[model samples]
Target: MKNMSLVIGLIAGMLFGGGLAYSGMADPARVRGFLDIFGHWDPTLAFVMFGALLPMAGAWQIQKLMKRPFADVQFSLPDTKKIDRKLVIGAILFGAGWGISGLCPGPGFAGIALNPAPALTFVAALLLGMVAHKFST
Candidate 1:
């Protein structure tokens, strides 16, 4: 069971990384272009976002019918529905970082394979931020 879980995780990660690469999301310049709404704004990433929603919507529907996940005892879904200051603040920080660096957690990690220099720098900063948050909270 553990081995199967590991295999599934590996495959999923590979697929996710491949998708990011194929969709040009792994490129910081491309992401920045998409984020830029006024100057030379690229609308290509919108398709990627819409494409992602389709699979996720289906997954949520499937999850509703399943008692338990195939590789897990429980669904391990987020139970929180309340929005608070922390959530709002975190979202602001996330948006700021994404705008500044054109890299979020997933792309930051995936970017390493495409361009290690900036990606490594982004990953290092990301890790530092995580550690700081852990200590502060």
Candidate 2:
């Protein structure tokens, strides 16, 4: 059962990676172009985001209907309703990084298959950031 679960996860990851690649999300230039609102802006990423949201909104509705997920593990949903200082700060940091590098976590991971050096560097920095968060918290 564990192996089957792993296989399913692998397949899902592959599909996600492929989607990122095909949608041009994995390309830093495309991502930067989308982020560049003032100069040489690209609106294509908006479609990719909309395409992603459809499935996610459906899943959210399905999750609300389900008493328990198909998985045996307990549901661990976010309960926060208020935006506080930490949330704002985190958002600022994340946005700044994304604006600067044009590589968020998903794209960074998917990029490993396309280009190893920069992707690995990004992953290392990401891991370090996680560790820093762990220590700070």
Candidate 3:
């Protein structure tokens, strides 16, 4: 079971990496270009979002149709659907980080995992930020 899980994870990672490469999303330069709204205002990232979201929505719908829960484990989704204060604040923070850095957590780590210098620095800083948050809390 463990080996199967490792294999599945590896396969998933490879496909995800290939998708990033195909979409030109693994490059920080392209991400930066997308962030430069005042200068070039590239819509490439918007297309990327649409491309990613379409398949994701389909997968969610398919999963919903399944009678048996995932891996026979109880299906647990989010408890709250309300747009509360924390949700708003978290959204604002997420937007600000993406706006400033042009890379969210997944792509940021993917970039670093693929061996980019800028990605390494950003990921290191991100880890430090996480540690700081942990200690402060």
- Return the top candidate by lDDT: 1
TM-score of 3: 0.76
TM-score, cand. 1: 0.96
Q: Could you estimate the TM-score for every candidate? A: 0.96, 0.91, 0.76
Clash count per candidate: 0, 0, 0
Question: By lDDT, highest first, what's the ranking?
Answer: 1, 2, 3
Q: Per-residue lDDT of 16-112 in model 1, one digit per residue for the tens?
A: 9999998898888988999999899999989999999999999999999999988878878889988999999999999999999999988999988
> What shift in Å separates residue 23 of candidate 3 from its native position after superposition?
1.1
Sort every candidate by TM-score, greatest first: 1, 2, 3
Error of 3 at 91 (Å): 2.3
lDDT of 1: 0.92
- Global CA lDDT of candidate 3, please? 0.76
